[model samples]
Target: MIKIISMKEEHIPQIYEIEKSCFTIPWSKDAFEKELKENPLAYYIVAESKGNILGYAGMWKIADEGHITNIAVHPDFQHQGVGTLLMQGIIEEAQRNHFIGLTLEVRESNIKAQNLYKKFGFVNEGIRKGYYQDTGENAVIMWKYFKE
Candidate 1:
Protein backbone atom coordinates (compact mmCIF):
# COMPACT_ATOMS: atom_id res chain seq x y z
CA MET A 1 0.00 0.00 0.00
CA ILE A 2 1.56 3.26 -1.07
CA LYS A 3 0.56 6.68 0.16
CA ILE A 4 1.61 10.05 -1.19
CA ILE A 5 1.86 13.03 1.13
CA SER A 6 3.53 16.33 1.59
CA MET A 7 7.09 15.80 2.80
CA LYS A 8 7.36 16.50 6.49
CA GLU A 9 10.27 16.93 8.88
CA GLU A 10 9.62 13.57 10.52
CA HIS A 11 10.04 11.88 7.15
CA ILE A 12 13.56 13.19 6.52
CA PRO A 13 15.45 10.19 7.91
CA GLN A 14 13.42 7.76 5.83
CA ILE A 15 13.70 10.03 2.81
CA TYR A 16 17.46 10.20 3.26
CA GLU A 17 17.62 6.43 3.40
CA ILE A 18 15.71 6.09 0.14
CA GLU A 19 17.77 8.85 -1.43
CA LYS A 20 21.05 7.15 -0.63
CA SER A 21 19.72 3.81 -1.78
CA CYS A 22 18.38 5.13 -5.07
CA PHE A 23 21.12 7.46 -6.26
CA THR A 24 24.88 7.12 -6.66
CA ILE A 25 25.16 10.66 -5.27
CA PRO A 26 22.42 11.52 -2.81
CA TRP A 27 21.49 14.85 -1.35
CA SER A 28 22.45 15.41 2.28
CA LYS A 29 19.97 15.80 5.12
CA ASP A 30 21.00 19.45 5.36
CA ALA A 31 19.98 19.98 1.77
CA PHE A 32 16.51 18.63 2.36
CA GLU A 33 16.23 20.60 5.57
CA LYS A 34 17.15 23.83 3.89
CA GLU A 35 14.71 23.28 1.06
CA LEU A 36 11.91 22.54 3.48
CA LYS A 37 12.82 25.44 5.70
CA GLU A 38 14.04 28.29 3.56
CA ASN A 39 12.68 27.72 0.08
CA PRO A 40 9.13 28.92 -0.30
CA LEU A 41 8.96 27.64 -3.85
CA ALA A 42 10.08 24.19 -2.81
CA TYR A 43 7.42 21.52 -3.12
CA TYR A 44 8.11 17.96 -2.05
CA ILE A 45 6.16 14.73 -1.90
CA VAL A 46 6.95 11.30 -0.55
CA ALA A 47 5.62 7.83 -1.23
CA GLU A 48 5.34 5.74 1.90
CA SER A 49 4.55 2.16 2.64
CA LYS A 50 3.20 1.34 6.04
CA GLY A 51 5.24 4.24 7.55
CA ASN A 52 8.51 3.86 5.69
CA ILE A 53 9.25 6.09 2.76
CA LEU A 54 9.70 4.27 -0.50
CA GLY A 55 10.20 7.23 -2.81
CA TYR A 56 10.17 11.01 -3.02
CA ALA A 57 10.13 13.89 -5.49
CA GLY A 58 10.72 17.61 -5.25
CA MET A 59 10.48 20.70 -7.43
CA TRP A 60 11.40 24.33 -7.31
CA LYS A 61 9.01 26.74 -8.97
CA ILE A 62 10.71 29.75 -10.45
CA ALA A 63 8.36 32.20 -12.08
CA ASP A 64 6.43 30.13 -14.63
CA GLU A 65 8.73 27.16 -14.81
CA GLY A 66 8.73 24.15 -12.57
CA HIS A 67 12.15 22.59 -12.17
CA ILE A 68 12.26 19.11 -10.75
CA THR A 69 15.07 18.94 -8.24
CA ASN A 70 14.95 15.23 -7.48
CA ILE A 71 12.90 12.11 -7.89
CA ALA A 72 13.75 8.62 -6.71
CA VAL A 73 12.32 5.31 -5.61
CA HIS A 74 13.76 2.70 -3.32
CA PRO A 75 15.38 -0.14 -5.22
CA ASP A 76 13.00 -2.59 -3.65
CA PHE A 77 10.04 -0.54 -4.80
CA GLN A 78 11.16 0.06 -8.34
CA HIS A 79 8.53 -0.76 -11.01
CA GLN A 80 5.87 -0.76 -8.32
CA GLY A 81 4.33 2.57 -9.43
CA VAL A 82 6.10 4.66 -6.79
CA GLY A 83 7.82 6.78 -9.38
CA THR A 84 4.58 7.28 -11.25
CA LEU A 85 2.82 8.42 -8.13
CA LEU A 86 5.57 10.86 -7.22
CA MET A 87 5.49 12.26 -10.75
CA GLN A 88 1.72 12.51 -10.84
CA GLY A 89 1.83 14.50 -7.66
CA ILE A 90 4.38 16.83 -9.12
CA ILE A 91 2.34 17.31 -12.23
CA GLU A 92 -0.78 18.03 -10.23
CA GLU A 93 1.06 20.59 -8.15
CA ALA A 94 2.45 22.24 -11.20
CA GLN A 95 -0.96 22.47 -12.80
CA ARG A 96 -2.47 23.85 -9.63
CA ASN A 97 0.08 26.65 -9.68
CA HIS A 98 -0.56 27.45 -13.36
CA PHE A 99 3.00 26.73 -14.39
CA ILE A 100 3.73 26.79 -18.12
CA GLY A 101 5.70 23.58 -17.98
CA LEU A 102 7.79 21.21 -15.89
CA THR A 103 11.41 20.41 -16.54
CA LEU A 104 14.14 18.18 -15.13
CA GLU A 105 17.64 16.95 -15.70
CA VAL A 106 18.43 13.26 -15.65
CA ARG A 107 21.80 11.61 -16.02
CA GLU A 108 22.30 10.52 -19.60
CA SER A 109 22.92 7.00 -18.34
CA ASN A 110 19.60 6.81 -16.53
CA ILE A 111 17.51 5.31 -19.28
CA LYS A 112 14.75 4.16 -16.96
CA ALA A 113 14.17 7.65 -15.64
CA GLN A 114 14.35 9.14 -19.09
CA ASN A 115 11.76 6.69 -20.35
CA LEU A 116 9.53 7.45 -17.40
CA TYR A 117 9.59 11.12 -18.21
CA LYS A 118 8.92 10.42 -21.84
CA LYS A 119 5.83 8.50 -20.83
CA PHE A 120 4.55 11.69 -19.26
CA GLY A 121 5.01 13.62 -22.49
CA PHE A 122 8.34 15.23 -21.69
CA VAL A 123 10.66 15.75 -24.61
CA ASN A 124 14.41 16.13 -24.59
CA GLU A 125 15.34 19.76 -24.88
CA GLY A 126 19.08 19.94 -24.39
CA ILE A 127 22.04 18.68 -22.37
CA ARG A 128 24.39 19.99 -19.73
CA LYS A 129 27.99 18.85 -19.94
CA GLY A 130 29.44 17.40 -16.76
CA TYR A 131 26.20 17.86 -14.88
CA TYR A 132 26.90 15.14 -12.37
CA GLN A 133 29.81 16.18 -10.22
CA ASP A 134 30.76 12.76 -8.89
CA THR A 135 30.66 11.04 -12.24
CA GLY A 136 31.23 13.86 -14.74
CA GLU A 137 28.33 12.45 -16.73
CA ASN A 138 26.20 14.72 -18.88
CA ALA A 139 22.63 15.54 -17.97
CA VAL A 140 19.70 15.28 -20.35
CA ILE A 141 17.29 18.14 -19.98
CA MET A 142 13.64 17.21 -20.56
CA TRP A 143 10.56 19.37 -20.52
CA LYS A 144 6.80 18.81 -20.51
CA TYR A 145 4.65 21.67 -21.64
CA PHE A 146 1.26 22.06 -19.99
CA LYS A 147 -1.27 24.17 -21.77
CA GLU A 148 -4.32 25.36 -19.89
Candidate 2:
Protein backbone atom coordinates (compact mmCIF):
# COMPACT_ATOMS: atom_id res chain seq x y z
CA MET A 1 0.00 0.00 0.00
CA ILE A 2 1.27 3.46 -0.89
CA LYS A 3 0.79 6.17 1.72
CA ILE A 4 1.26 9.89 1.20
CA ILE A 5 2.05 12.34 3.98
CA SER A 6 3.68 15.68 4.67
CA MET A 7 7.38 15.48 3.98
CA LYS A 8 9.68 15.41 6.99
CA GLU A 9 13.32 16.40 7.42
CA GLU A 10 14.49 12.80 7.35
CA HIS A 11 12.94 12.21 3.91
CA ILE A 12 15.02 14.88 2.19
CA PRO A 13 17.81 12.55 1.07
CA GLN A 14 15.49 10.10 -0.59
CA ILE A 15 13.36 12.89 -2.00
CA TYR A 16 16.52 14.47 -3.38
CA GLU A 17 17.41 11.27 -5.17
CA ILE A 18 13.97 11.03 -6.70
CA GLU A 19 14.09 14.65 -7.78
CA LYS A 20 17.49 14.21 -9.38
CA SER A 21 16.43 11.12 -11.20
CA CYS A 22 13.27 12.76 -12.49
CA PHE A 23 14.58 16.09 -13.67
CA THR A 24 17.53 17.32 -15.68
CA ILE A 25 17.92 20.19 -13.23
CA PRO A 26 17.27 18.96 -9.73
CA TRP A 27 16.91 21.26 -6.73
CA SER A 28 19.69 21.28 -4.14
CA LYS A 29 19.36 19.82 -0.67
CA ASP A 30 19.93 23.26 0.80
CA ALA A 31 17.10 24.62 -1.31
CA PHE A 32 14.72 21.98 0.00
CA GLU A 33 15.87 22.68 3.54
CA LYS A 34 15.39 26.38 3.05
CA GLU A 35 11.94 25.84 1.62
CA LEU A 36 11.04 23.73 4.60
CA LYS A 37 12.31 26.32 7.01
CA GLU A 38 11.41 29.65 5.48
CA ASN A 39 8.34 29.02 3.37
CA PRO A 40 5.31 28.82 5.62
CA LEU A 41 2.93 28.94 2.67
CA ALA A 42 4.76 26.12 0.96
CA TYR A 43 4.13 22.42 1.33
CA TYR A 44 6.08 19.25 0.55
CA ILE A 45 4.54 15.83 0.60
CA VAL A 46 6.03 12.36 0.17
CA ALA A 47 4.77 8.94 -0.81
CA GLU A 48 6.11 5.82 0.84
CA SER A 49 5.40 2.13 1.01
CA LYS A 50 6.62 0.14 3.97
CA GLY A 51 9.95 2.01 4.20
CA ASN A 52 10.73 3.60 0.83
CA ILE A 53 10.17 7.04 -0.61
CA LEU A 54 8.57 6.65 -4.02
CA GLY A 55 7.57 10.19 -4.89
CA TYR A 56 6.99 13.72 -3.66
CA ALA A 57 5.49 17.12 -4.49
CA GLY A 58 5.90 20.71 -3.35
CA MET A 59 3.64 23.71 -3.76
CA TRP A 60 3.29 27.26 -2.57
CA LYS A 61 0.03 28.97 -1.82
CA ILE A 62 -0.03 32.69 -2.29
CA ALA A 63 -3.32 34.28 -1.36
CA ASP A 64 -5.91 32.36 -3.38
CA GLU A 65 -3.57 30.66 -5.82
CA GLY A 66 -1.53 27.53 -5.36
CA HIS A 67 1.53 27.11 -7.51
CA ILE A 68 3.02 23.67 -7.82
CA THR A 69 6.76 23.97 -7.55
CA ASN A 70 7.76 20.37 -8.09
CA ILE A 71 6.43 16.85 -8.43
CA ALA A 72 8.13 13.56 -9.23
CA VAL A 73 7.97 9.85 -8.68
CA HIS A 74 10.93 7.52 -8.79
CA PRO A 75 11.39 5.81 -12.15
CA ASP A 76 10.89 2.47 -10.50
CA PHE A 77 7.52 3.49 -9.16
CA GLN A 78 5.98 5.23 -12.12
CA HIS A 79 2.53 4.14 -13.45
CA GLN A 80 1.57 2.45 -10.23
CA GLY A 81 -0.63 5.38 -9.12
CA VAL A 82 2.06 7.16 -7.12
CA GLY A 83 1.89 10.24 -9.30
CA THR A 84 -1.90 10.31 -9.18
CA LEU A 85 -1.95 9.95 -5.44
CA LEU A 86 0.64 12.64 -4.99
CA MET A 87 -1.37 14.99 -7.17
CA GLN A 88 -4.54 14.19 -5.29
CA GLY A 89 -2.80 14.90 -2.02
CA ILE A 90 -1.67 18.29 -3.27
CA ILE A 91 -5.14 19.13 -4.56
CA GLU A 92 -6.70 18.27 -1.23
CA GLU A 93 -4.18 20.42 0.58
CA ALA A 94 -4.90 23.36 -1.67
CA GLN A 95 -8.63 22.98 -1.08
CA ARG A 96 -8.10 22.64 2.65
CA ASN A 97 -6.21 25.91 2.68
CA HIS A 98 -9.02 27.61 0.73
CA PHE A 99 -7.03 28.27 -2.42
CA ILE A 100 -9.11 29.54 -5.32
CA GLY A 101 -6.95 28.10 -8.07
CA LEU A 102 -4.00 25.82 -8.74
CA THR A 103 -1.39 26.10 -11.44
CA LEU A 104 1.75 24.49 -12.82
CA GLU A 105 4.06 24.36 -15.79
CA VAL A 106 4.67 21.16 -17.64
CA ARG A 107 7.33 20.42 -20.20
CA GLU A 108 5.83 20.78 -23.64
CA SER A 109 7.04 17.36 -24.61
CA ASN A 110 5.62 15.64 -21.57
CA ILE A 111 2.28 14.57 -22.91
CA LYS A 112 1.65 12.09 -20.13
CA ALA A 113 1.82 14.80 -17.53
CA GLN A 114 -0.32 17.10 -19.62
CA ASN A 115 -2.96 14.40 -19.90
CA LEU A 116 -2.92 13.80 -16.19
CA TYR A 117 -3.42 17.46 -15.46
CA LYS A 118 -6.18 17.65 -18.03
CA LYS A 119 -7.95 14.77 -16.36
CA PHE A 120 -8.17 16.94 -13.28
CA GLY A 121 -9.65 19.87 -15.24
CA PHE A 122 -6.55 21.99 -15.72
CA VAL A 123 -6.61 24.09 -18.85
CA ASN A 124 -3.78 25.71 -20.75
CA GLU A 125 -3.23 29.27 -19.63
CA GLY A 126 -0.19 30.18 -21.72
CA ILE A 127 3.37 29.27 -22.50
CA ARG A 128 6.59 30.19 -20.75
CA LYS A 129 9.39 30.61 -23.23
CA GLY A 130 12.52 28.77 -22.21
CA TYR A 131 11.22 28.15 -18.75
CA TYR A 132 13.56 25.21 -18.34
CA GLN A 133 17.07 26.34 -19.19
CA ASP A 134 18.76 22.98 -19.14
CA THR A 135 16.89 21.78 -22.21
CA GLY A 136 15.88 25.21 -23.48
CA GLU A 137 12.34 23.89 -23.56
CA ASN A 138 9.14 25.87 -23.43
CA ALA A 139 6.66 25.16 -20.69
CA VAL A 140 2.90 24.82 -21.09
CA ILE A 141 1.35 26.60 -18.19
CA MET A 142 -1.85 25.03 -16.85
CA TRP A 143 -4.44 26.15 -14.34
CA LYS A 144 -7.43 24.86 -12.39
CA TYR A 145 -10.09 26.99 -10.72
CA PHE A 146 -11.81 25.94 -7.52
CA LYS A 147 -14.67 27.27 -5.46
CA GLU A 148 -13.74 29.85 -2.89
Candidate 3:
Protein backbone atom coordinates (compact mmCIF):
# COMPACT_ATOMS: atom_id res chain seq x y z
CA MET A 1 0.00 0.00 0.00
CA ILE A 2 1.31 3.46 -0.86
CA LYS A 3 1.37 5.89 2.02
CA ILE A 4 1.57 9.67 1.94
CA ILE A 5 3.71 11.09 4.70
CA SER A 6 5.58 14.25 5.62
CA MET A 7 8.88 14.54 3.84
CA LYS A 8 11.99 14.02 5.95
CA GLU A 9 15.68 14.59 5.50
CA GLU A 10 16.30 10.99 4.57
CA HIS A 11 13.84 11.19 1.70
CA ILE A 12 15.70 13.96 -0.13
CA PRO A 13 17.98 11.66 -2.10
CA GLN A 14 15.15 9.64 -3.53
CA ILE A 15 13.15 12.74 -4.24
CA TYR A 16 16.15 14.25 -5.97
CA GLU A 17 16.35 11.21 -8.20
CA ILE A 18 12.75 11.60 -9.16
CA GLU A 19 13.27 15.32 -9.83
CA LYS A 20 16.24 14.59 -12.04
CA SER A 21 14.32 12.03 -13.99
CA CYS A 22 11.25 14.17 -14.43
CA PHE A 23 12.57 17.65 -15.12
CA THR A 24 15.09 19.19 -17.44
CA ILE A 25 16.04 21.76 -14.79
CA PRO A 26 15.86 19.76 -11.60
CA TRP A 27 16.66 21.19 -8.22
CA SER A 28 19.78 20.10 -6.38
CA LYS A 29 19.85 17.97 -3.25
CA ASP A 30 21.15 20.96 -1.32
CA ALA A 31 18.11 22.96 -2.37
CA PHE A 32 15.82 20.29 -0.97
CA GLU A 33 17.79 20.26 2.24
CA LYS A 34 17.49 24.01 2.57
CA GLU A 35 13.78 23.90 1.95
CA LEU A 36 13.29 21.23 4.57
CA LYS A 37 15.54 22.82 7.15
CA GLU A 38 15.57 26.54 6.53
CA ASN A 39 12.38 27.39 4.73
CA PRO A 40 9.76 27.83 7.40
CA LEU A 41 7.03 28.35 4.80
CA ALA A 42 7.67 25.14 2.90
CA TYR A 43 5.68 21.93 3.30
CA TYR A 44 6.51 18.74 1.53
CA ILE A 45 5.18 15.21 1.38
CA VAL A 46 6.30 11.90 -0.05
CA ALA A 47 4.53 8.84 -1.33
CA GLU A 48 6.12 5.66 -0.12
CA SER A 49 5.34 1.96 -0.39
CA LYS A 50 7.10 -0.40 1.95
CA GLY A 51 10.63 1.06 2.01
CA ASN A 52 10.70 2.91 -1.30
CA ILE A 53 9.63 6.39 -2.23
CA LEU A 54 7.48 6.61 -5.35
CA GLY A 55 6.89 10.36 -5.59
CA TYR A 56 6.90 13.70 -3.78
CA ALA A 57 5.15 17.07 -3.67
CA GLY A 58 6.02 20.41 -2.11
CA MET A 59 4.40 23.78 -1.52
CA TRP A 60 5.07 27.09 0.10
CA LYS A 61 2.56 28.75 2.34
CA ILE A 62 2.51 32.44 1.58
CA ALA A 63 -0.04 34.63 3.28
CA ASP A 64 -3.35 32.82 2.76
CA GLU A 65 -2.17 30.95 -0.29
CA GLY A 66 -0.35 27.72 -0.98
CA HIS A 67 2.01 27.84 -3.94
CA ILE A 68 2.84 24.43 -5.30
CA THR A 69 6.56 24.27 -6.01
CA ASN A 70 7.02 20.82 -7.38
CA ILE A 71 5.30 17.48 -7.83
CA ALA A 72 6.97 14.51 -9.40
CA VAL A 73 6.44 10.77 -9.59
CA HIS A 74 9.08 8.25 -10.43
CA PRO A 75 8.94 7.14 -14.03
CA ASP A 76 8.18 3.57 -13.07
CA PHE A 77 5.30 4.72 -10.90
CA GLN A 78 3.75 7.10 -13.40
CA HIS A 79 0.08 6.50 -14.36
CA GLN A 80 -0.39 4.41 -11.22
CA GLY A 81 -2.20 7.18 -9.29
CA VAL A 82 0.88 8.46 -7.51
CA GLY A 83 0.39 11.96 -8.87
CA THR A 84 -3.21 12.00 -7.80
CA LEU A 85 -2.28 10.89 -4.32
CA LEU A 86 0.38 13.58 -4.06
CA MET A 87 -2.07 16.23 -5.23
CA GLN A 88 -4.62 15.11 -2.69
CA GLY A 89 -2.05 15.22 0.05
CA ILE A 90 -0.91 18.72 -0.84
CA ILE A 91 -4.43 20.04 -1.19
CA GLU A 92 -5.42 18.54 2.13
CA GLU A 93 -2.48 20.18 3.79
CA ALA A 94 -3.43 23.53 2.31
CA GLN A 95 -7.04 23.24 3.39
CA ARG A 96 -6.02 22.14 6.86
CA ASN A 97 -3.94 25.29 7.20
CA HIS A 98 -6.86 27.40 6.03
CA PHE A 99 -5.27 28.51 2.84
CA ILE A 100 -7.69 30.53 0.73
CA GLY A 101 -6.26 29.24 -2.51
CA LEU A 102 -3.64 27.07 -4.13
CA THR A 103 -1.58 27.97 -7.15
CA LEU A 104 0.95 26.39 -9.45
CA GLU A 105 2.79 27.04 -12.68
CA VAL A 106 2.94 24.20 -15.14
CA ARG A 107 4.64 23.98 -18.50
CA GLU A 108 2.14 25.08 -21.12
CA SER A 109 2.95 22.09 -23.29
CA ASN A 110 2.41 19.53 -20.53
CA ILE A 111 -1.19 18.75 -21.28
CA LYS A 112 -1.29 15.72 -19.01
CA ALA A 113 -0.24 17.70 -15.97
CA GLN A 114 -2.57 20.58 -16.83
CA ASN A 115 -5.43 18.12 -17.08
CA LEU A 116 -4.60 16.66 -13.71
CA TYR A 117 -4.60 20.11 -12.10
CA LYS A 118 -7.92 20.86 -13.75
CA LYS A 119 -9.36 17.66 -12.35
CA PHE A 120 -8.38 18.86 -8.89
CA GLY A 121 -10.35 22.10 -9.34
CA PHE A 122 -7.44 24.27 -10.43
CA VAL A 123 -8.34 26.60 -13.28
CA ASN A 124 -6.07 28.36 -15.68
CA GLU A 125 -5.66 31.91 -14.50
CA GLY A 126 -2.95 33.37 -16.70
CA ILE A 127 0.33 32.68 -18.44
CA ARG A 128 3.99 33.37 -17.77
CA LYS A 129 6.14 33.86 -20.81
CA GLY A 130 9.38 31.87 -20.86
CA TYR A 131 8.74 30.53 -17.41
CA TYR A 132 10.84 27.44 -17.92
CA GLN A 133 14.54 28.16 -18.19
CA ASP A 134 15.50 24.91 -19.84
CA THR A 135 13.34 25.16 -22.93
CA GLY A 136 12.03 28.72 -22.67
CA GLU A 137 8.56 27.28 -22.51
CA ASN A 138 5.59 29.33 -21.38
CA ALA A 139 3.92 28.42 -18.11
CA VAL A 140 0.23 28.10 -17.51
CA ILE A 141 -0.64 29.63 -14.18
CA MET A 142 -3.39 27.72 -12.42
CA TRP A 143 -5.24 28.38 -9.22
CA LYS A 144 -7.77 26.63 -7.01
CA TYR A 145 -9.78 28.96 -4.83
CA PHE A 146 -11.35 27.57 -1.68
CA LYS A 147 -13.45 30.62 -0.90
CA GLU A 148 -14.83 33.80 -2.41
RMSD for all candidates, in order, please.
0.9, 1.0, 0.9
Candidate 2: clashing pairs of residues: none
TM-score of each: 0.97, 0.96, 0.97
Give the per-residue lDDT digits (tens) of candidate 3, residues 3-114. Answer: 9999999998898899999999999999999999999999999999997999999999999999999999999999889999999999899889999999999999998899
| Best-first order by TM-score | 3, 1, 2
Which sections of candidate 3 miss by over 4 Å?
none
lDDT of 1 by residue, 1-148 (tens): 8889999989999889888888888899999999999999999999988889888999999999999999999898899888999999999999999999999999999999998999999999999999989989999999999988
Regions of candidate 2 where Cα sits further than 4 Å from its true position: none
lDDT of 3 at 56: 94
Of 1 and 2, the candidate ahead on lDDT is 1
30 in model 1: Cα distance from truth in Å?
1.1
